[model samples]
Target: MGTLNLSFQIQTLYMSPSSPSFNTFTISLTTNRKKSNCSRFSLSMGNPNDTHTKLVPGAAGFLLQDVPHFTDYLDHLPIVVHKESARGVHFRRAGPRQKVYFKSDDVNACIVTCGGLCPGLNTVIREIVCGLYHMYGVRKVLGIDGGYRGFYAKNTITLTPKFVDDIHKRGGTILGTSRGGHDSVKIVDRIQDRGINQVYIIGGDGTHKGAAVIFEEIRRRGLKVAVAGIPKTIDNDIPVIDKSFGFDTVVEEAQRAIKAAHVESESMGNGIGLVKLMGRYCGFIAMYATLASRDVDCCLIPESPFYLEGKGGLYEYIGKRLKQNGHMVIVIAEGAGQELLSKSLQSVDQQDASGNKLLQDVGLWISHKIKEHFAKKRMPINLKYIDPTYMIRAIPSIASDNVYCTLLAHGAVHGAMAGYTGFTVGPVNGRHAYIPFNRIIEKQNKVVITDRMWARLLSSTNQPSFLKPRDIAEAKKEKYPANGILDGKIVKTMSMN
Candidate 1:
């Protein structure tokens, strides 16, 4: 085991609009290239057998070994962070309060929770308000109602200690959020006139570009305003942070749902279940669930190809399940094989609350296909459930991620007080963290998803993440050998792959 190195800086290279073509621009971040540098975060776990333990970062997480760069590593390392507007602004914080002038402390800072809600949002917001007023001694903490729309329509009000006193354990943000708000010159002017020097935005990646627009516009007006982004998405797709706050909650929730499906799938004499998770373009939530809950016969993700025919991935899984336990549960990410494999995406009509195209239920669609495939033989008893709504996003409380959220929130407050602007706080090593407030408007993060994660996923595929026990229980007597998907195939994969 050796020292851990996992810090990076964001640098953006391009941007494009959503049309018949790509909607989001590719981004990047620079991390210390240490293929040979071992991450000591995981090595602290003294022994592999301990079930109840905590592994801190920079401990004994890795072992020293000669390393070589992969052929496609550069392709995956394209984007980490990007701020289209803030890269061009500069404003010193107003000095400490004087009778004739207001200090940065006097300048108000407010946070708005917007767009479709995700897990762990309240935890982030709670830390913001509590850390801001109590720790920093800044008085006003505004909670804008209904997201970006609230900001545009001037539907703002002040938040207080009483407002965030007990919000950490809650599900949704007290300020609420709307995806409809537009960032405009008029909006930025209003924010400046109101004496708000800093604005905290907590939302998915969609809201980040808008935040950039406001910061840029404010700086253009020669205002000393700073804006910070807190990433929130159940998909856990954001690239900069080692992992977003809501990811744990979403995975926990998905694990529970998969367990239920597994139980039912196994109870039947002949059965099959397909559990679909909510993931649009990113497969983090889906991949994490598969890793956490090993109950599924086969796991499918959008990042990688899934084969349902012949004797490969999907077909073999069902055949083995029927031979051993007679029933099996399958876990899938909604975005996995979307337009090509998901009926939800292929449906002629779909829409969400705000009238956006509905990301249909991938679970049901997969289940139908399995049923159709096996029904001709009269051998399958299939049941399916889509973990839609708030199942994964409404988790109660988890210590590991709760601690991470607390640190991020508290760190953001510190950043504000220290006059750190246009930067974000996120975990670096498992324990240590970093800040990315640059010297000036600069390139955004260059964060591209790494295939290392995908490789780990493939190697672990046959081993069956935490699911070997249930898989063994349901697996039929191995008169035939498909050594790949059974026991001993699983080696320890305790880290967040």
Candidate 2:
């Protein structure tokens, strides 16, 4: 393998109204690569001279200092100071640029939503359409219906400010969505045929992978199309971002189910309430919901392993809690304790159309197990199980998520217009930045059991950690290395906040 060297300089100008002066800060980033399986850690762009003229209108007062230059970037590892090696990873800051590559009159943009339904999907779609029309004087915008297949199969819907005016008030996506319909060749061909120069893809991990393929194909064909992705996942699993779009809404909506479970359990004699939320590989939903509810006695997630039959296990903890409180509420992620289910049921693993594993209904399985365990002890228990998996994801976004979706959509639009390609837009460290597709899709972010947030959850619920000595050792190894390097790549510490 050969080393890939990249260098960029950022020029930031600070101006004060009273002082009538400005200060400039120039930061340079140079990275030296030795060995890595990941793709190039830089945002791809079109011709350097493509963007030479300022096209955005009605911003004459602050355009000179407000617009970010092409060289501006955000350091990926801001806290890490590698004194020995003059190498650092950085991402281009996402915002309006002084110069734009695509002329407003010549630009034709399209947006598509793929994967499962999520809260605020329509909010993102509406913002993209409105942002382009109102920000830049672009009039031609198309909505790709039915995901990737829509690029070639279905008819396109023309989007306007009036058409998507109140879409944010509605749930789900107006463009429609599907899974496992990616065909990069056909999609790019249709894009070329239709003269669409900008593409915005909104989806989760699998959908982002498909977007990466489409971007590569466009780049290979020497097309001028810019591909941008807005990460969307109800599970909050996408890495390198503060949180996914629908995550807050899902967490908020999940509280309704938890509240109902608490009410049902508290009303019945020797009552037990079990609520399952949406989390396939991560336990953020379950953990956060439990902490917010403050009524749960026990919480189970995939990151922490628990056995039912052993001492200090789930069964013993439940018995003790019920005996003390007379009623108890338990929360479990969808992916929690899958190995136990698999071994007990001896079922074969299956996958969905999007290559995701079809998870067994752990909510029902565990409820049955708890009933059997109490029955053997000649104990009477009334257990209420609530699975709000679909309900939480299908509802409209709350106030916070609606504002967040608007910012994300605008960031993506700015990047695409500035000729940045193969990137996703999201808040990194609370500031918006354009991240390469390879970075966000490299790994799924999971809830860190050893983090302070998990500790807080345990403290609030008074539940056992359900962790063994070996599990602790494994978690330590899984965290970011002390040297700020992992597998020959610089990585940020995992954060649950």
Best by TM-score: 2
Give the range of the ten consecutive residues with the poorest summed lDDT in model 2.
Answer: 59-68
For candidate 1, write residues 1-497 as lDDT tens digits. Answer: 33323332222222233322222222222233334322111112222453112122231111111111111121111212212132211111111111212243675988887677776677788777877777667787787778877866667767777867677777766677777557558667677677777678776555665665675576456565557667666666654345777777777877777877878777777766667787765677767677677666666765444556664456656777678777777777776656654433446666553444656566666777777777775765666565644666765447777777777777666544544444555643232222333311122222122335544664655523332344445433322211010000111111211
lDDT of each: 0.55, 0.78
How far residue 152's Cα lies from its native spot in candidate 1, in Å, is 2.5
Models 1 onward score TM values of 0.66, 0.82
lDDT of 2 by residue, 228-288 (tens): 9999998999987779998888888989999999999999888999999889999999998
Clashes of each: 35, 0
Poorly placed runs, candidate 1 (over 4 Å): 1-105, 342-358, 386-389, 430-497
Pairs that collide, model 2: none
After superposition, which runs of candidate 2 have C-alpha atoms over 4 Å from their true positions? 1-88, 481-497
Worst 10 residues of 1 by lDDT: 481-490
Best-matching candidate per lDDT? 2
Q: What is candidate 1's local distance difference test score?
A: 0.55
